[model samples]
Target: MTSLASKLTVIVSAAFEEAGLPADLGLVRVSDRPDLAQFQCNGAMAAAKVAKKNPRAVAEEVAGRLKARGEFAKVEIAGPGFINIDLTPEAIAGHLSAMATDARLSVPEMAQGETVVLDYGGPNIAKPMHVGHLRAGIIGDTLRRIMAFAGYKTLGDVHMGDWGTHLGILFNDYIRSGEQDKVLKVDLDDPASVSALFEDMSERYPRASAASKEDEALRAQAQEATLKMQNREAPYYEMWQKVKAVSIVGMERNYGMLNVHFDLWKGEADVHDLIPPMVDDLKARGYAVESEGAIVVPVKRNEDKKEVPPLLLVKRDGAFIYGSTDLATVVERMQLYGPSKIIYVVDQRQGLHFEQVFRAARMGGIAPDAVELTFAGFGTMNGPDGKPFKTRAGGVLKLEDLIAMGVAKATERLNDANLAKDMPETERASIAHKVAVAAIKFADLQNQRQADYVFDIDRMVSFEGKTGPYLLYQAVRIKSLLRKAESSGSETRGFGNTEIQKFGDSDIPLALLLCELPDVFEGALNNYTPHLLCEYAYRLAQTFSSFYNSCHILSEEDEVLRGSRLTLCTLTLAQLELVLSLLGIEVPDRM
Candidate 1:
């Protein structure tokens, strides 16, 4: 399963050591300019500087030494000291054939898998799902699946935002409006009523804030309710449970739509009891101090002597801020899972918050030194205006609205393409929805996680370009060809990869790309960026398209050549599906 570049480097690296130069100097990579060669090693120049010699002279000596290995057809010294190694057809075919029969395509699992606890999908109680939550849910969910596939035991949690002043606002508003009995006595099992109550509260929440701003009595009631809720008063606690229950309805439905789920619905309130002791412990350890009548735990940005604002643990009036609960949750998670790592798949806005929490946890001994904490922050899903996404009337777009928007664009495309015009109405509906979900997820996942991307439904669901639907359509085409081959009584499996030795020239490029799948996956995992995997998928799909257009598969007169092409097609389909599954995209057999 050694990569072509790695094998090339291994043989050449010994030459460097034999020549009394740096041994691991000639690290090779797939060449950017394919017209030149398949791979290039530019490390000789750096090695020359290190050894105080002419770079070209060093490269020539390295090339002379590499020639004994008999792998490269041509190892030419290019610009400065760049050594471009063109793999012999025999070498390329050997690797491709090896990959053809091997599962994992050549990517091996890590020697030691981690027990990871992933914190994501920060859905606030009483609030409906919004576009803001989409990234965390999609990214975290995909990471969980990928981690498991990569042999890590992953535990994904929905960090529900249940303990906050907002809870008090919703409670007081409902109690004052005299609709308390309807929520308590009515069909609590009805999702509609729960959703309706949540939606109504969401709408009135801002009004409640505005009213309380000028009204002292209302403000007092809200604060009192918050204190009571935290203190476990029967009324506030009971209403709080309803708040969480109703919110789960929306959370589950929206997350399910995106194929996102959580191992635990552990919210802020779950760690409430721990917060008091945790804050006191920090205070006892002198990590926490009183400042301006509030308790705060100051955290440093680094080992350097610079300092940022401290994380406020509690206000003067005894109501806790988010920081306290976050620190407590860290303690609780460590106690429960004893995980190797806890990755927080949050957006970039909370970058400072997490840094502070992690630091505070470590500073206060809440999180152990053995446990690794990572904040996998992503960018926002913005609208065309370059701000956070919104609807036609400039209101914040909900998750359901985004889904509907995607489906509509997909439906419009299906109509324009006249695709599946003969299909049943129900069948068309199902296909369009799958396309929509796939399109939306792919569009977001393709972008670098920390860079904001505009959400454009029309561009995403289009069957052309690098959209998800295009990939799905490509996969479908491969399935169709394979099915046709099988139906014609053509032998599909048991084709020896010996035929791969005959593929050269135009087909060589595709073969080379296919063999690099393992390296591409390793690079993606190393960086914690699925966009790397997305890039690999797009390139593979594009290369396979070129191969399909040039080399006929099912229609080829020669059975051996046809079988080789079919094998390539099957391998491409498997790897494409693997990459898509990692990015949380799905492919249907039919377009």
Candidate 2:
């Protein structure tokens, strides 16, 4: 299942060696100028520069050898020594036939056995998730899927922010409000009681958090509560556990709606115990020192062009901060999973924070140099006003509410289009849910992760353009086409047939695009850019649409041509579905 490009590179690389030049100069890529050739190699230009010879002369020598091999239909030197290649129709057909049968769709397992840990979905306990958490959940889930598809063992951690000062504030407020006894006595198994407790805490938490910022006494009490909880003291620790349990119920319900599941439901609490020892090790090893009463890791280096503040691990009051927990989590992950890489899918604004943490981890010897600590930071999802999206009241919109809006919009679109009108109510509901999720996920994933995008449910749920529903519609269209062909007694047996009668105008382009699937996937995975795959999927759908419009399959009298076209359609659908799945999008059988 070697790709056509790889095969050509091998042939052309050998030609470079035969011409008494460096074989590495034979790297071949899909031609940028599709009007001239199917593939191009600019190696002769580089080789000429190194060998001090005319690039055209060098291209001629390599072209002569390539022509002798007879693998390409045409091998000609283009302007200034670019080698443009045209594969024979038979060669294209051969690759397409192989791709039609390969389950991986000719995509190689680039990562093989590498282990990767993805940290995302950082929701705090007692606080409901908001639209701000949307990008992290969708992007991280998609990355995990893509990495897993690339043969990497991936562990996705929701990394809930359960153990933090916010919890301490809630605890202080709960104690003063005399609700601690009720919360303690409530049965954890009773969903209603737990939900009520969580709701009360959620309401009180905002008030307490706001008050702590204004009242020095309440702030000190919260800080003390935090230290006590960290020390596993009395009812505070037990109450913290109860709060965590109730919060998890709501978290699971919300994340479940988005179809974002984490392999590990761990959080700051899981690493709290490791923080003390890690801090001790850092201080003992001279990586951490007291900076104005707080223990900080000085990560600033001489080559730094901008200020790199020291990572504060412990405050003067003896409470550990986020850096301590994050550093400890890294230690725990390395010791537990031994992952070769850990990618943090967080907001781009936290770039400096992660830089300090990564520097401290390496400087403190907490993480080995071989393990990559990367920050896959993303930009904000803005409203039409170019500001962070919020409810009309200027409040942070809940994640559940956002999802509900998408679902409602999707249902309305379905009704307007008169699609799924005859289906069962339950089935229609399921389709709407799928469509909603696809719209939301695709809208977020279609952008470069580091770039900001406006949230437009209306445009995203449309059945036309580069929307998720459009791709779903195209996939459904092909499925319907296949069903009709099957009913007409047109068996899908041409998948293994390599002898295509003749290449139509659109057929070769579709075939050539199919061959680029592996390259697209590799590019996406290597750069952690899902937009590359997004662009490819949209183009593939559009190309297939063109091919379908030009070529009539079921009505064709020529059986071979009809079968060949059907095979192309079938392969296109498989690839389309495959790419969609990698984007964490689910395609319905019909739209």
Candidate 3:
């Protein structure tokens, strides 16, 4: 269905056309003024300015020539020649019922399904997962789900940073310390122990390097050892395998807890060999140049950083940088999937890096408009000290431990609420566990992506205000009401398939509330913001509460009115459940 605003504007424009006025007032938009009416048109004021006539006269003249025609109850002139449209109760009821019967939630399908790739959940090898990774995981997963619901084929890639100098550092540390076996059993989150090991390794590597340099024979032996590890030579190969095994197992546990899965977990190491040919092509196409023995993309440098140097594609030592790896991935995606769009759920700090890559991709003739890039910025979790987030002892926090903390906090609230008091103790605990995870996911996603957010468990797990658990509570409440209605053999009379059926004598408030869903969905889709959906859920919950308080569906004497209202209640619950699902929030049956 065309939205209420879209439908009304079309009718108003038709009236203007019939009155022999200028039909072209450019495009019009529905103004946000609930105090006046449902929809308002401001085109007349602009048209008056263009025609050198008074705005009020133009508005009244347009209104006089307009026929009522049942689309709206009244069209009155409001402030400064704005046309305030009051749609009929029948119109609101009809639109809402149409949404209930339709499966797309009244959202339009794409003209043709498009292929897009979402890069998120970036966990570097040998680095512990932390809250820094949480934002990307949640936001990217939501975006992928949203696009897929809108019928786009989306590939969710983790884009792991599994190859880099850090790997070399870790590998070298393992070799020198002769703790190759311990690498296989290290618990990455025991901050006290892990920090000491990492620091000791870091300190010893440099000292050993200096000593090796002073003794040429020793330096040669160390170089030989590194080569063996790189090429998967006998003993060093076994050691490298052990480190990778520990790291992958740890990352998988985190992903499992987060409910995140990647369509592909290919790392920079997987695509390392593809970089050289891409670099050669960039050179051949004049897109790259040699600078101090390193290959560089010749994009104009940022004037803001006068002292900072240009981006180097390859180091002077002929090692490929992350930029080269990203370039290769972009080319590989274009050639493999031929996607029309690509979204990177990376940080705002990497904005310049992506801009460089996008320009290079365009120059490479991959897809001029074929690649679309979006960088989602995230906030850091700070301790009580208010510095960049760290443990009390000043170590990085692991993601798994943070989630566990959320779960523990959530369990306490659920127990205090006594929501499932009569249920078996074990079952209550399991439900609380899922609810806790949902609360964490919802809290992170309820805000706009660009803003910084504090990870406060107390604020996140509360059952009031704009929160995940609150939304879940509303859903559970609706389910309870519906179950009661069904047990009593209540027959519900759904508003039928007509696009403009009347609501009869039923209170129009519930019908009016239901009509707002299409607007909510439209805003959510176009703005690329899930918070809009959160706002919708909040309003829906409020509307349901208001409906229950003012109108009693179960006790109304008139059977048709009672049946119709019951149906409205049932349909509202379904819509609420669908919306919560869209946001990745799960509602427990018993709350």
Task: Kindly give the number of clashing pairs for every candidate.
Answer: 0, 0, 0
Candidate 1: segments with Cα more than 4 A from true spot: 213-217, 301-306, 412-426, 492-499
Q: Write the per-residue lDDT of candidate 1 for residues 136-162, one digit (tens) a residue.
A: 888888778777767788899999899
Candidate closest to the true structure, highest lDDT: 2
Q: In candidate 1, which residue pairs clash?
A: none
In candidate 2, position 524 carries an lDDT of 87
lDDT of each: 0.81, 0.87, 0.68
How many clashing residue pairs, candidate 1? 0
Candidate closer to the true structure by lDDT (higher is better), 1 or 2: 2
Between prediction 1 and prediction 3, the one with superior lDDT is 1
lDDT for residue 482 in candidate 3, whole number 0-100: 71
In order of appearance, the predictions have TM-scores of 0.94, 0.95, 0.85
Better of 2 and 3 by TM-score: 2
